[model samples]
Target: MDSQRRQLHLFFLPYLAQGHMIPAIDMAKLFASKGLKISIVTTPLHASLLSKTIEKGKTLGFKLDVLIIEFPCVQVGLPNGFESYHMATSPDLRQKFLKATTILEHPLGELLQEHRPDCLVASVMFPWATVVARKFGIPRLIFHATSFFSICTSECLRLYEPHKNISSDSEPFIIPNFPNEIKLTRKQLPELFTQKVNDAGLMELYKQVIEAELTSYGAIFNSFYELEPAYADYYKRVLGRKAWHIGPVSLCNKENEDKARRGKEASIHGHECLKWLNSKEPNSVVYVCFGSMANFNDSQLMEIAMGLEASQQQFIWVVKREKNGGGKEEWLPEGFEKRVEGNGLIIRGWAPQVLILDHEAVGGFVTHCGWNSTLEGVAAGVPMVTWPVSAEQFYNEKLVTQVLRIGVGVGAQQWVRFLGDSIRREAIEKGLLRIMVGEEAEEMRSRARELGKMGNRAIEEGGSSYSDLNALIDNLRSHSFAVEE
Candidate 1:
C-alpha cells in the first residue's frame, strides 16, 4: 500500500472538563479530517456532550469514534452521572470530580489494550496515560488546552519561583527569563504556584504531570505559532522537545460545507444567537461569558447586571443557571431586566460562544480569560475586557492584555474562588467602556482584527498551523509504517 494510503489510528484522552474535552474533540476532528482513524476515550456522561461533534465528523467523512468507559462517580462521592467537573452542582465538589476522573485509569488501560491505537494523545491531567502508552509502546503526546504563552509563563514561573521572597501574594513581581517585560502579582498565580497551601495530593498530581511531559514523545498545543511565535519557539528550544502548535481548533467548525449542511440542526441555539446578532449594529454589542465552570454569588451577579446595564452597549450574556447559584431571576437586581431589555439579551443556558464571537455584530468581549475563550476571541477579532476569575485564567489575562495587546484588563488581579472577592459594578462598567467606546477601544479593535486575520490564515491551507498539523499527521503516518514493519 502507498505510504499515504496506510491506515492510521489515534486515541484521545481528555481531562473530564468541558474546556479540556471540547478542545480534544476539536483536535480529533482536525486529525480525522486528514483521514486518520480517531477515537476519543471518555465517560458516558462526557460522551453525550460530544455527540454532535462526533456526528459532524462522520458527516464530513472523517473517521472518528467515541469509546465510553465507566465514570467512577459513586466511588468518588459524586452524584450519579456527575462525570465532568462542570457537572458538579457546586464549585466545592470540583476536587471530588477530579478524583473520580483519576479513578478511570484502570478502565482506560483495558480499553487502550483493546484498541491499541498508533498514538495516544491525552489531556495534561491524565499523566497515567503516559505509563499505559509506554507499556504498549505507543507514541504518547500530551494535549494542553491552552496557549503556548501560558505554557511558557507557567513553566518559567514554576522554575524561577520569583514570588518566594514576597511576604504578600498581592505584591507585584517581574517574571524572569522572558523576551518582554512580563510582570505578575503573586496573587494572580494559581493555587499550585502560590506555595501558600501545601496540598500533598495536588502537588503529587502536578509532579506526575510534569514527569509525564518529560517522558512523553512530544506535546500537542491547542494554539497557533503565529499567535505567540516567540513563546512557541522558546518552549521548543528551551524544553528541548518537539511541540506542535496547531490550534484555534475552534476553527474546525468553520468548515463551510459541513456547517451549511448541519448548521440549524447541529445547533439551534447558535442559529438563534446569530439571528439576534444580525439585528444589532456592527461593532456595537458586547459579548459577556465567564466560561463553563466560573460561578458567581448573588451580589456579583447583580453587579454584572448593573454594569452591563450601565455600559449602555448592546450585549448578549450567556448565564448558566446553576453557575449563578441556581436562582437566576432572584439574583439580578429588580427591574434590571426590564431596564436593559432591548439592549441586553441574557441567555440562561449554554451559548454558542464561537458562533456569537464569529458574528460581525460583536465588537467587544467581557471574558474570564480562559485559554479557549481567549483564543476564540482572538479568532473572532474581538477585543477583550479581561476579568480573570480563577485557575490559570490570571496567567492567560496577561497573555491577552499585556503580551498580545489586544485586550484591556478589568483590574481583577486576584484569583477569586467561590465566595471570595467580588468585582463591583464600577469596575465592570469601566472595563466595558474601555473595550467598547473608550479612546483605546479602536486601537485595540484594530489589533484584535489583525490577530484574528492571522489566526484565520494560520488554519488555512499552507498556513503555519495547517503545515504543522499536516506535519504531525505525516509523522504519525510514518510511525504507523514503522509499527507494521
Candidate 2:
C-alpha cells in the first residue's frame, strides 16, 4: 500500500480542443484515482474549460492539477480566443493555431525541467513535448485520441502510399498491411497525406507528430482491446512499441444510479432536450449532431431539415450556426420549425451529447463521425448514420459503416464547407430511414449494444483495460524509483 503511493507524478499535454481535452481530463482523473499525482498542462483559457472536471476530481479525492502556460496568441497574430484548433474560423487560421502550439516548447521545457514529472503524456499536437521529456529523462507517452484502427490505417497509408498511383482523388484504393481489406479513396485521406497545404508550418508539424510517435517510449490509446483487438495487436507488431489500451476513458463520466436518482444527468445542453427524450418511446428518436467544428451552409442545413421531416422519425438535431452568420436567418426552410415541432427538437448550439446518447429514446445518431463522437456513441450503444463533414471524419465514417458494421452512411464522400448537389435531401432521408427504421437498424443496434457492453466491462475490475491501467501505474512507479536510485 505504501509503495502504491510512490509519489509518482505524471504531466499531461492535451490538444486544446473540447474532444481532446475532455478525454485527457478523464484519463488524468482515472490515474489520480489510483494514487498518482497528475497535472494537466494547458493555456489559461483551456484550463478554465476543464475547471469543472478538475474540481470534480478534487471532490472525488484525487490530486489533479491544471498547470497553465501562456498561449502565444498575440505572437502568432491569431485573433483573440483563437488559441485552439476548433476556434479557428478559416483554414489559414487553423494553420496558425497549429503553429501556436509549437510556441509552448520553451515554457513547457522549463516547467518539465523544474517539476520533472515521472512521465509526460502528451497528445500528438505538441510533438515538441517528446524532445523536452527526453531532455529531462522523462518517459514520454504519446496520447493518441484515436482508435488503434485509425493509427494502424494512417501508418499503413504513410508507409504504402497506395493512393499515389490512383487515377483521381475519388478512385478507390485499398490500404496495405491492414488487418482487413479496408479501402479508401484519396479524398477520404487526411488533408496532410493527400496534398501539400498552404501552411508549411502545419505540414512540418504533422511530420513532427509522426516522428514523435516513433521516438516516444510508447503510445497510449483512448480505446480498449476488445473494441479493436486485431488492430491493437497489429499496431504493436508494426509500430514495435509498448502501446497500452486503457480506455473508453469517457466511461469515467458515467453517472451511477445514485447520481441519476439525485437527478444528475451529464446534460451540457438544456435539460429540456433530455426531458423531450423522456416523453418519447424507447429506441425511437434519431439524434443529429455534426460535432463542434462542422459548419454546414444554408443549403446543406435546409436539405438536412427537409430530410429529417421526410424520415418522420422522432428527432433531436443540434445545429451550429455558420461562423460568418450568413445562414442563421435563412438556413432552415420557412415554417420548418413549426412543421416538425411535435416530433423534432432543433438545438442551435452545443448539446449535451453524452446525456442524449445514453438516453433510451436516442435509437439512432446522425454523426460527423469524429473520433470522440464515435467513441461516445459506441459507449452509449447508439447506432450511427454517418455524415462525415471534414478532417479525418470520412475515414471514421468508413470505420463505423464498413468495418464495424454498426452504422449506415449518408454517402458524404467528401468534406464541404458549402452544400453541393453531391448530397441531396433524398439521399439524406434514405440514410436516416436506413439507420432509424430499416431492416438493418435492429442488427446495427444489436452490434452497437454488444460493443457498448464490452466497453463497459473493459473498464470494470479484473477487466483488460483495468489491468492495463494498473500495469501503467506500476511501470511508472518503478521508473520513478529507479530514477531516484
Candidate 3:
C-alpha cells in the first residue's frame, strides 16, 4: 500500500464471466490489502461461483457482496446467460439483453446512491456499467480484459477504413496513425471486426466499444511493464489517460501467503498442481489448457490429442467434456489415452490455471491466445505455443509472436472464422516438439523464465506496476464525486 495515496471506496463490476469475475475478485483483494473497502457488483450465479474464494479472503478484511443482475440465458436460449461475449453472434440476444439490463440501470443507480462508493471500475466490454458511473459522477476506470494489441486494433479500426480488409497471412500493414506494434490484415483483427462478421451482431457491439473507448478517464491493464513497455509508454505519452498495469491478478490472492507454494512432486490436488511440477526436469512437461471459454472443435480436439502424444513429452491437459452448448464428446484416436495415461494427468471442467502455471514442472503453455491466458503465461515467464480460438485471441497471438519473441504460432495463417479448416495433426505434433522438447524449445523456456522474473519484480515494493496502481488510486480519490467533480 502507498501511504501517500488516499484510501478509496471502490466498486468493481466485471462483465459476468468466470475469467472476468476472477480478476475482478483479485483486484478487490488487492484493494483490501491497501485498506480500502470494495463492493463487487455481479449476478447471483457469479457470486456463487466465487463464494468459496470469498470465504477464504475474509482473513484479509476483504468483503464480497453480490448484487442482482438479469441474465438473458435464463429467460432466452443464449448460452451461459452472459450476453456480452455471445452478443457478437446474436443481435436479437444483444438487443434483448440490453433491454433487460436497461431496466437495471435505475435500480443500480439507486443502489449506488444509497452506498455512494468513491469510484467504479468496470470491464471495458460492458458500457452499461459506465452509464451508471456517469449518472453518479463517479470516476470510471475501464480495465481492458485483453492485451494492448487488441485495444490498439479496435481503436485503429474505429479510425481507418483502409486497414479494414487485411488477413492473418498477409504481410505487415500499419494501423493508421498509431505508433505501437499494432499491425493487421483485415483478417488478423478480431473476427468481430472482420468484414466476415458484418452480418452478425458484431458491428453493433463494436459501435458500443468505440463509445466506451472515447469516454473513460482512467484504465487498468493486466500486464507488467517489461512485457509491453512500448505500448505502456505510448498510452502514457500519447493517449494521456491514467493507465495502471498492476496485475497478474493471481498474485494478489492468498495462495502465495499460504506457505504451500507447491513444490515439485507432491500428490497432485487442486492446490498442489504446481507441487507436481517441482519433481519434473526443466523444460520437460507441457501445460495444456485454454482460457475458461476457449475450447476446440471435435476434429481439432482429436488432432491435439495426437499431437500431445506424438510430442513424446509429459503433459497435464485440462479436457472439459463440453464447451459452451457444444455438448457431448469426441472419441479419441483409439487407445491413445491408454498409451500416455501414465505420463499425463487429464483434468476436466476446471483446473487451478494460475497455480499450475506457477509450478516447476510446467515448461510451456499451449494456449488459445485469450488475453488473460497470454498475460498470465507472460507473468509466469512461460513461453507459449500459440493456437488461438476466437474473439481477440488472434490479436493476442500476434502480440505473443511479433511483439514478444517468447512464443511461436503453429499455423501458417490464422484469424479464421470457419470450422472445417483446422490445423493438421502432424503439424500440432511438430509444433509442440519444436516448442517443448528441441533445443529451440529450451531457449524459449529460458526466455520465458527471464520474462516471468521481470513481471514478478514489477509488483514488489517500489516496482513500476505497484507505483502506477498507487498513482491510479490517488487520481481516483481526487476525482471522487464526494470530493469535487
Per-residue alpha-carbon lDDT of candidate 1 for residues 1-485, written as tens digits (9 for 90 to 100): 56688778899998877788777888888899888899999888777767777787787798998999998878978778877666655434766776776788888789888988899999889888898888888899999988777788888888988889777877888878886788888878877887665566677788898999989989999888878988899899986768998888889887533333321132235566767888998999999988877878777888888888887889998775643454547778877777887788888866667878888999999999889899989999999999887778888888898888988887787776533347889989988998888679999999999999999999999999999999988898887777777
Write candidate 3's Cα lDDT for 186-288 as tens digits: 5465555555654444466557756775676678888777787777776667665557888766666446433122111122366456556666786677888
Report the Cα lDDT for residue 383, model 2. Answer: 91
Clashing pairs in 2: none
Q: What is the Cα-based lDDT of residue 339 in candidate 1?
A: 86
- Winner on lDDT (2 vs 3): 2
The models' CA-based lDDT, in order, is 0.82, 0.81, 0.68
Superposed model 1: Cα runs more than 4 Å off: 87-95, 255-268, 322-328, 418-420
lDDT winner? 1
What is the Å distance of residue 141 in model 1 from its true position? 0.8
- Where model 2 places Cα greater than 4 Å from the true spot, the runs are 1-3, 256-270, 322-328, 416-422
As a whole number from 0 to 100, the lDDT of residue 129 in candidate 1 is: 85
| Count of steric clashes across candidates, in order | 0, 0, 10
